[model samples]
Target chain A: MSRHLPIVAVTPFPAAAAHELKDAQLRANLGRATRTIRDKRARVVAEVPDWEELRERAARTKDEVLDRLPELLARFERAAAAAGASVHHAADAAAANAIVAELVRAQGADRVVKIKSMATQEIGLNEALAEAGITAIETDLAELIVQLADDTPSHILVPAIHYNRSQIREIFAARMPGFSAESDEPAVLAGAAREYLRRTFLSAEVAVCGANFAVAETGSLVIVESEGNGRMCLTLPGTLIAVVGVEKLLPRMADLGDFLRLLPRSSTGERMNPYTSVFTGVTPDDGPRRLHIVLLDNGRTKTAQDPVGRAALRCIRCSACLNVCPVYERTGGHAYGSVYPGPIGAILSPQLTGQDAGANSSLPFASTLCGACYDVCPVKIDIPEILVHLRQTGPKPAAERAAMATLSWVMRDRRRWRGALRAARTGAVPLRALTRRRGGTLRRAPWPVSAWTAHRDAPLPPPESFRDWWRRTHAE
Target chain B: MRIALLVTCLNEALFPRAGMAVVTVLERLGHTVAFPPEQTCCGQLHANTGYAAPARELERHTEAAFAGHDVIVTPSGSCAAHLRAHTELPVYELSELLVDVLGVTDVGARFPHRVTYHPTCHGLRMLRLGDRPQRLLRAVSGLELVDLPEPEQCCGFGGTFALKNPGVSGAMLADKCANAVSTGAEYLAAADNSCLAHIGGGLARRPGAPKPVHYAEILAGTGAAA
Candidate 1:
């Protein structure tokens, strides 16, 4: 709660990015974590007989949900209300944060327990709650480590992925009482965290969690997790508040079977998650007595309206896409500067937030559109298509725009391509001067060409185009 | 068969030898290769850069250029991939034609150097021609093949992206080159000249960077021609 949020005014762009890239320890930590998870996921996925079929089904189901989103939201609201749950609608990030803060105030609670949730992270909800004088304690083990260390989560499933066991031991020793760097084992760390969070779970009057899926027909909120900490957060508090994005809703309860089957297999590579929690509303003796569901729009409606970009909403957050993404493998999650990371994040964040020129703008170009994310996506969001669509909307540098405009003309006419080829062939000798000579590789260039030369060598064109040779031999 | 060589715009103006290599390989296989002069760029640069309207206009010109050809062959895998996915015509990257379409087991080409092959993103992911290029490259005589770490990762020569986000793009390219260097190969070869041009250009500038050769050039045994 109060501990989780800290305001950093500047959006993470060139400055933050350059600094992060320079840290070798962080890079090593992230690389190890992501590779281990990625390899494990691949092995587990290989065992499933109908994995491709399940992916197709999951994709189709998500597409169906997106098509009738408004209707589904209405249905969810009615069913949730009928089950004695009050639903709140948030039009933007600010609205969602304010709604959550107001709910915290209404409960008259100074501290609360929070389950790991990206939607909360996206709106900086914890920071807002802190501003309102309420403390939010992140109960998830990885999230707690991140909060305690005052660091952003680097991976979606593993928030503390950028920290190794030694790093975690150091953070715990500094931040938590009765913790020591000498006790760096997983069991020791888990024991210390369990002891710390136990008090928060019991003492906190209200609990906040994010739903993995919200069923429209039954008003059921579902959470799938490997750790049982989520279960404690959901049941221990007197009041429960769930903040979910509008795109989280699925059309029917039956659809959950495909997703539940697809998600665990694709994500953590488990046939089934260790803990599965589902609730329609506050149960008399089973869980929290008071239930509140905040259905946050936050630019989802605008994304849903896009013919090409809307498909990005189909993500189940299984993070299978992230594991296979090459870009994600190298740059890591923090480089993305969004709660969401990897391929799905590249497409989803831009649409959800309208590609703001800062961090959001850079997201669209983050990937090479390698399509690995699309291939692995259980929901088949066509991540590459949305990436291209968002790239169209994102601002381009002045020189780039002009160059692209000129290239467009060359592409639109056959004569222009031929003419350019002819020009290159005759000037190949002089063009060599444009190249910088190193031992074996070429060196840097001036402006735009320097961009390529900065990293690799520029290829030299031969003396003739294919058309010239064909005409000389075949006379076609 | 009437074969129309779609010498991709990059191959036309920047790497004509790649286009020539495609022709030489096809003709050596006993097919009459024709270059439809009216053919231009695949409009991928425009399409990828977010100028779809003009890209569509280019697409129209391309559709007209090789309208009646029985098959279209290209040295550039990315261009062939773009056409396979975006255009109505049947298109093949030169490597695909050598193996899948032409059924040629041996290319009769030789390259003695240790080489690493990059699975250009468009060919591997977009067009779904998985592992075919590597198979063809392996068939060439005297070629030592090594695995490229993260072979499918993009080299970041995403047309205007290189210019737009120069810093990130540069970082990505550095990683790509580092991976190629890690293989300790004498050369890095790929099917697409557009991506090759970008990577090759960068490798050329490295103090002791191994050269990057196009797949067509390797298959045609023209590594030293330039």
Candidate 2:
């Protein structure tokens, strides 16, 4: 929503990751939380006999939405408006922020209760609201923790995943107006958050939310959550403003059945979340008196144009990919330098902002391409494939470009390849000498290639390549 | 059947022994193996690193290298996957070639050692060589195949990923090594040597670590060779 893209990493991924690695406590918290979620997801996911088939269907459904996105969005806007809700289209993040801030001002409310929303985070909506003199209060427990500490959300589902229970207890005790300084229990923390937000929720005149899915056929917007805070925010406010990415549309309401099943299981590893709230425009004084939907297209249209990268838009923000990611487990979300982090963030962030948008270029290289994220993604988004596609199309350092060009030329012919191998074997001689004391492996390497040797030893190339061996042994 | 051994550029240059082992195992099973000298790298390095033009060129070259062979087999799963994606060649990972194509789970090899298998990311997820390597290891007499805890996790040898994200890569490799050590096996075996090179390098730095061996080397070994 801010015209400015949130400052992506000022430092590249490796540097940020290295700095984060020194946080032993953060790593421990992430390791435990992610591992538990990983196991839970695997267990429940395995229970479905037709899980793969369901994934395929989900993927196909999203692809259909993408193929007919313009039509579906038009239908959704018509239905929402016919049902008495005002629908606003935003071309970019700044436009989205301006629209939401103006809407909040129109409501004449100085404070708004917020449901946890990545779309809002992606747009820097809270900051925009602050600039407009409106206080956006986050109701989700993790969101509350991050807001109270004046810190950025790290993980998507659990924004404060970097903090253990004890750390969170300390935060609440220090920051909350009234707090017993003695408890570290998760229930205690949740209770403290509930009490802290209850006052804000009851008195809030305007509420801003993000929809998980917007049904075009039925003109309904849905939000699924574990805590009832989202429910309270949706039903209690006089004015409701839902800012959702355009990609959140489904062709029909029945499509919600598949997603509802997939989203909870994939996200929290639960059979079903505790609360699911669905609403259409202006429900006759029962809910908010007014409904406003800000349909945001901050580079989504461009992302949808990509044949391969467009599959990333199918993401339900389940965080299944993040939970199973080895790199995310190590570096945490901060290293990715985006609201969306881990495998999904690696591809989605770069595409949403354009690959050349600041340090977003570094996001694609954040993963090991382990394929775990792809396997766990409910929509079957081939995240690794998209990462590779972005890397090919994204800007590369000039030296790396030159080296790859030279290598490509050298690899096109067998004769050149053999020659390169001979040269490499010769180069290995000096490297082999450096490793002689450390057995047959080099523990450290010189500049440019030093990255490989920093963590693991490199085995020196053997004296004879198999090509040469074949020529000498069998060819003779 | 005559099989052309598409010893990937990595195997050809660094782990020629793995290539030789592939040849030895196939030949022992009454299959003729031919080394296509025209073959070089699979261009995975170029492809994965965002150099698609070179990667495509290398892909075309690979397709030409093993054009007329009855079957193309490679010991490296990552290379085979890359080539398969780019070309119509009937490229097969060594385990797939043995267990699926040749219909031989065991190659009558005997190695009396406790070994744990690490399924590389390409082999495990890309090729979905689910339990095929395990099936082959089970058939090898006198070989003890111990299960690797969290075997599906990547060793972080993502070609250039190791260099680019050395810190994260190292952390992952440490977890992998810890799991391998927990298995209490004397040897760690996998289909892809590139991963072994990465994992083995880490093991080499630590005292009393399991020796990383390629599955081809394990399958090719006879009791006498051991």
Candidate 3:
């Protein structure tokens, strides 16, 4: 296992979110992109009469895969090897990166093109390849934009969603040699990226990619994308290395049918993505001559062992949760400080790295638990349930734990609860005095309570609680 | 039916009028509501803030407190949802009780004012209390129930979330308040007072904005002139 943890936020989530909230441009860009994508997803999803059923089936299928992950992985490995592909097991990020770097070096290729892969990003493979003196170029438009800008990806599907068209234009002009300065149109920008990467794609001897799904029955790997970059990277290279998370496996090839229908509409809001490249092992005279599959466990087994949190592994990286998340919509993805961001990130990152993984433990507390992410999830992950589960299992601050312990003792008894309530009501007298100037609302509070009043006004506790009123009125 | 009122912790301490409205409306409908003094909170705050043991204790207290009631009704959808999730009780949000159980869309109340309803996230998504509150509001005599733009979006009260992630929560509340204001409604109503507190707090900051009112308060009105 890699002792090196994936990049986690040095600053906690609340502080990071507060910082991200100060940037108006980033928020506007995120708001527009998320709203557009959410609307499109809703429209496309509405077209399917069996969308709910599809979601249920997808959830069930994913559960079954989790239930039999070890067996299915073995099945997949055997089938893939039989199809003339070399299969490698990576216990963690370091092993995966080392394997891929070695593969690239053996091919005598210092430069390799890439498809947009969350798995590769998770393992920091690009940086590892660079350490081995190899240049890995991102081919997907969004990934390419983020790579060129030398920025960390914020959103999963749309890595550079924090940047608007004009910002992207600026990055392209400053970074790409011979790029037009005035063109800000999306098509224009896309054409520039295509021109920039076309030669690299043709001349590259090796490609590093991630698989959206790995079928255990047929030894087939699937890559779904809006742009044709995934197709180019998958086919043009002489040697193909796919870094896949073990959770991305399906029991059979036929299972791909349901996911194919669910993923596109849920993701890019397209009824079908522009490109879906599926390859089995290696082709004799076509496509990549040699294929290598690196199946990574990086804390996946631990997550799968958790009955409540295991559902998080069902995610297909659709970004549906991110689009619908009010917290994400406000703070943008940088606040999450993980390769995964938004609601899914809130659960997935913490579990993948384990809660004690420094600032990553704060991820579970990042959401309002509004359940928007749960409602929009294609696989019915029940993200709120998982979040709460993770919170129970994760680390707790000593003060909070002590407070809860005291509160639990009080709440278990009616007399103690009423006394506590009376004490709280008496304690609020000063707060009430402060709020009297602003129509019985406190604009600011002190210490622990200040977290609330800092942003919105808080209501003063009534002179009499409902219990007091009930006793006074109904005592007779 | 033996109906017990689970006046949520927030409603009990801050907006007691909303709890009173629930009682008045229920009494007017020929039902005697019982106040199980043993009932304190649904433990939503504790549970949501990553304190599961205390939440479970509160849940056990609630389950024991309202153990024998044939039905338990609360004005807050979010609290009722917490109860439904944690306890094996027939807990209902006010609208669900009136419309689904009692089969009365018109609750025989009236408020002559322009009102927009913000479907708090818990009621809309968790309980799926779709159109129940709206149908009741529509039946009220001389009340204009205006449409709130993005009614489905969260008000961002989110229990501890309002405090922990105040910036994002405030941003969400600002958008919600702006949407409520755009409807030109005199009153903004929702099933949950916690949401109203946040939305109302933001509205109060803006001069001449609509005041936040609990839906039960509107339903408890009797064609009275302001």
Q: Please compute DockQ, using alpha carbons, for every candidate against the native two-chain complex.
A: 0.57, 0.80, 0.72
lDDT of 2 by residue, A397-465 (tens): 999899889877877788888888888889899778777776678887788667777777777788888
Give the runs in model 3 whose Cα sits over 4 Å from its true position.
A1-7, A427-437, B222-226
- What are the runs in model 1 whose C-alpha is more than 4 Å off? A1-16, A356-359, A418-428, A431-441, B182-184, B205-210, B224-226
lDDT of 3 by residue, A1-476 (tens): 33344446667898999899999999889889999999999999999999999999999999999999999999999999999999999998999999999999999999999999999999998888888899999998889889989988999999999999999999999998778758798889988888888978889899999999999998999999888888888888889999999999999888899999999998889998788888899879899999999999998999999889999999999999999998999999889888899999989988888887869888888887889999889999999999988888888889878987887787788788778778878989887877776678777778876877677777777887887677776676
Position A66, candidate 2: lDDT:
96
Against the true structure, what is model 3's DockQ?
A: 0.72
Q: What's the C-alpha lDDT at position A14 in model 3?
A: 87
Clashing pairs in 3: none
Model 2 lDDT at residue A434 = 71
Considering lDDT, which of the candidate structures 1 and 2 is the better prediction for this target?
2
| Candidate-wise lDDT, in order | 0.78, 0.88, 0.88
Pairs of residues at least 3 apart in sequence or in different chains that clash in candidate 2: A1-A93, A1-A123
Q: Could you tell me how far off, in angstroms, the CA of residue A49 lies in candidate 3 after the best superposition?
A: 0.5
Candidate 2 positional error at A393, Å: 0.2
Best by DockQ: 2
lDDT of 1 by residue, B11-105 (tens): 66766777778777878878887777777777777777776777777777888988888888888767776677678988887767777888885
